[model samples]
Target: MKRTTFSLLVVDDDEDDRMIIDDAFLEIGYAGQVKKFMNGKMLFDYLEQIDPSFYPSLIVLDNTLPKMGAEDILTLLKESPAYQSIPVVVYTTSLSPSRQEKLLQKGVYACYQKGEVMEKVIELAKQLRELAESNSPKE
Candidate 1:
């Protein structure tokens, strides 16, 4: 099957993690854009500036951030009519079961623990690529 190109927005405080994710996608030869933000504020700012038609196909959010945590960012996205339909996947180093449930209840598409190995991250990148392609506009 042919794959459709799409854009993904990732918000994570850790620069190394972001680089790893980007590299993983590249390793898979994902034919889409991967934009990274350091925090929720930067993500929101970019969102605000983009045309609605140009909005990202998916958003990957880190559960913990220096300012404006994942929950806050998720709430805002869910509340916004323009952003509500975009899928959000939460990535975290560690999460309690209750917290994961809470994030799901708030409308995140999925929650995944950060992988310890590069291979694991590559697997995650593949999943993310599939999701982005699935969400892409049908031609």
Candidate 2:
């Protein structure tokens, strides 16, 4: 089967983190495209004109951001039927209990500390690629 490149959305305020994620993707030789968004508000606005069928398969979210925090954006995402199918993975430095709890409640598919982000980002890309190629949702 011809593998389709997965589309990943990197929603982070920090430029460096986005670069790291991009590097990780390149390292993995992933057949996936990543769209960078510095803030959720901007991401949301951009999504307005996009077809829901092109919704990203994976969303890498940073815990903290300006203009719009990850939490608020997640809330809005959950409320949108068209955009809710994307699996969100929280990759951030903060692993505080309160933040973790809220993230879990909001249905983050996975959470990883920034220390392990590079490895996890590569893993995430591989897993999503497998899922897409197999035409099945990961269990």
Question: Which candidate gets the maximum lDDT versus the true structure?
Answer: 1
- Compared with the true structure, all predictions reach lDDT values of 0.89, 0.72
Candidate 1: tens digits of C-alpha lDDT, residues 41-86: 9999988987787788899999999879999999999999999999
Cα RMSD, model 2: 4.3
lDDT, candidate 2, 9-98, per-residue tens: 778888987777777767877624667789987788767867665566677788888867778888888888887776777878878888
Clashes of 2: 0
Q: List the residue pairs that clash in candidate 1.
A: none
Query: Which sections of candidate 2 miss by over 4 Å?
Result: 1-6, 116-139
